[model samples]
Target: MKDTIKEKVASAVRSVYGIDASDAIEKASFEPPRKKEFGDVATNAAFILAKVLRRPPLEIARQIAEQLSGEKEFTRIEVAGKGFVNFFLSPRFYEELLKKIVETDFYVSDIGKKKKVLIEYVSANPTGPLHVGHGRGAVVGDVLSRVMALTGYKVDKEFYINDAGRQIKLLGLSIYYRIQELAGRNLTLPDDAYMGEYIVEIAKELMLKYPEIVDMEEEKAIELAAEFGKKVLLEEIKKTLERLKVEFDNWFSEKSLYNDGKVEKVLEFLKEKGLIYEKDGALWLKTSQFGDDKDRVVKRSTGEYTYFASDIAYHYDKILRGYDKGIDIWGADHHGYIPRVKAAIEALGESGDWLEVILIQLVKLFKHGEEVKMSKRAGNFVTLDWLMDEVGVDAVRFFFLTKRHDTPLDFDIDLALSEKSENPVYYVQYAHARISSILDKAKEEGIEPSTEHLNLLREEEFELILKCYGLKSTLESVAKKREPHLLPYYLIELASAFHKYYNKNRVVDTDSPELSSARLYLVSGVRKTIRSGLNILNVNAPGRM
Candidate 1:
């Protein structure tokens, strides 16, 4: 629809000025009317062309409106608000579009052009199950992947395992000491050792499997402990994500970067480019030259690779895997880490544009007006599993996405479980359910959905139709902005308009069967659109919620 309007406007511009103004034509875009009196679609083409035409924008707008007045696509075209051209679509236009909804199986565009995207998210340390913090990043990455895929990108969901380095060694030591304590050896845990009860659980499980681990050398025992802990926690992470209905296309192991010599390979490349420097026995990347506040250690003095080094290798591996773009969903705390990673990408001779990171703020859980404290099992924050069992997977994904990624979200445990209209997710699902009920009832009454009398649809009915039509644009915006929160908000507004419409009008009125069929046609479209939007967010939109 936008393309049709833009093409006509481009033709009008040529006819009026006798010159090509493709750039201005491209700049011309439409906005929904600020007032119903302003008409269906409003554009500012004349405002863009005013200087080029050497005329007042308002005069140019009037001339353009005059030229377009004969267009059958628009029933009314008028100039208003400093050269804004308001266009009211012909009744035929709305009738055809609303009919297209239920008459078609699905409607989506190939806007992404099949660009391959690697979306790496929730790469939490395998120290414990994912908490609410990791859950936020998971949803962001997961939904972004869905959005990109819908926009026609070839997307691969991934979780990068931080299974190598000091953290892993500490994980092993934490479990080993816990095992020692359980075996009657009161070994003191190191200050940096993990302190979660899950660590003890892992230790107990390991004891049963490796009863002779105590007899092994200390260094060898810790290695075995670390490997065991990493495997267990990683499996748990996978299960938790699976339960949350968030699955990754790949689980790229950070240990592989070291094992496959990716870390050393990138390190050597940087060294030869003079991008890496040795400082006090540590190999440092001159990240300061690439917008970091200071140089960063890729490898510490003790010969252990830094987490940043592993991240570089992981991304380099992504590039080597033939992805056109790479996106990493990270905690907001890692905002400062973006530049160093970008620097590494550039140092590896890839454009920084190839890698983009979305930093998401943590989620805070609240219950009954007070902070829901403690993870009972994990010993600290709320785990994603706990939240899922408490509320539901649908509510968890929906509510987690109700706010922008950069904003801290306070998940209301009480609100999510509430079936009342105030629950946003439930409210939207109810809209779908209501439509399904109407369609089902219509089927029983022998009044099938059809576009038989679409002309009977009034202006208020177009409110829902237009909003449903906005879905494609909404999704395109989401993919372009790299924000998935826009989807829920759009859904909420669409659902609200639909529910309000249902309150005032009947979708399956037996008294007016033709009108009923048309309205049912619109309702069916609305239901499918809502379901599709929910599906993209990985939220459920049950036909009977």
Candidate 2:
């Protein structure tokens, strides 16, 4: 749409002053005016070209306006506020948009050329179940992927499993000792051992799968248990995500990268670039040269590669897969990791811009204004599964995305579970269901209004139609900014506008057929918009809630 406006303005400038398109068009900027009275759209072309044309900005704007006099889409074009070209679009423009909305299957406009994008999110360690903090990242990444896909981007949602790290080793040892304790054997669990009942359950599963390993030495038993525990835990994680309405295209494993020699290849590439050097008996990457805080170790003195090294290999694999861009959704606690990862990408001679990181802040759970404590020992952390079972998947997802990704989220359980209409998710869904009910009534009454009769829509109908037209721009801005919170806010505002219109007017009044038909068209458009918004958030838009 911006491109369309730019071309039209450029053509008008070229036709008015006989200036070259390149020079005249290069100076133009299309911006939405701040005030509706100014216009729906505005440009600063006259201000930019005033000096080159040796004329006042208003005079240049006047000449361009004269050249664009017969443009039907724009109702009026005028120079305002020291050379701004303000254009008020004709009501027919909005009518056409409404017709398209009713005729189309989706609400969002097609703005992208369907570029493939891989979004890896909530790649938490599988040693334990996901906490509420991980849930925030999960919902943000999921909703963003949905929004991008809705806007015509081919999105590949992914989860990176860190099953090959020291955490997994600790998990194995924890289960081995817990099994010993359960068997009346004296053994002390290590400090780093996982302290959850799930460990005991995993140990039981391991004993059933491989009874021969139960009698082996502790070290060997731990090694076997770690491998088995990782698989079981990962399965549970997948189940939890599925319950939350989240799924991934791929589950990339860190251990697979090691088995395939991808880590070695990434290190060799850095070595070839002179970015890796051995210092103090440890292999270090010169990340400081690439704007990192300090040089980081790729391999520690203990001969074990650091997690950062594995990350570099993982990202290298992503680039090798031929994706134009890669995105990682992580918790805010890992904010310090961004610069080093970007430095690694740069050191590898790839553009750092291709790697994007979205940091989701912590989620603080509250019940009646008091903090809800999480106990790892009792397995009482607010897991995503528990949240879904309590308030349902739709409410959980909608609440998670109600705030900016970077802002701290407070999940009030009492408020979310309330039966009142104050809950925003319920409110939005209710509005949609109400509109659906009205449409159903219309359909049953044999009063099907065709698109031709939609031309009789009134002022409130046009206002709602204009709001629908802004969805394209709103979605574009939200996706480009990696912000999904805007969608929920827009949904609430749109619902409020609809409810206000609903309270003031009667949709099925038998006296005036024109008004009734117009109201029906407006209601149909609102229903589509509501469903589209809910779909992007992974929430349900029910016919009856």
TM-score for model 2?
A: 0.92
Tens digit of per-residue lDDT, candidate 1, span 1-545: 56557777878878887888767766777887778788878898888888778889898888888888898889989888789888888878777777665565334667688999889899899988889888888888888888888888899998888888788888888888998898999888898778878988998999999999876788899999999998999899999998988888888888888999999998898899999989899999987877677888999999888888888788888899999999888888888778888987887888888998888997888999999767878886678999999998999999989999999999999999999889999999999998988889999999997776788888887777778877888888899899899999999999999988989987777889999988888888899889889988888778786
Cα lDDT of model 2 by residue, 243-299, tens digit? 888889999999998999989889999999999999888999999999899999999
Q: Tell me which residue pairs clash in candidate 1.
A: none
Whole-model Cα lDDT per candidate? 0.86, 0.82
Best candidate, TM-score: 1
Q: Where does candidate 1 stray beyond 4 Å? A: 10-24, 46-68, 79-83, 105-107
Compared with the true structure, the alpha-carbon lDDT of candidate 2 equals 0.82
TM-score of each: 0.93, 0.92
Model 1 has an lDDT value of 0.86
Query: Clashes in each model (backbone N, CA, C under 3 Å)?
Result: 0, 0
Best by lDDT: 1
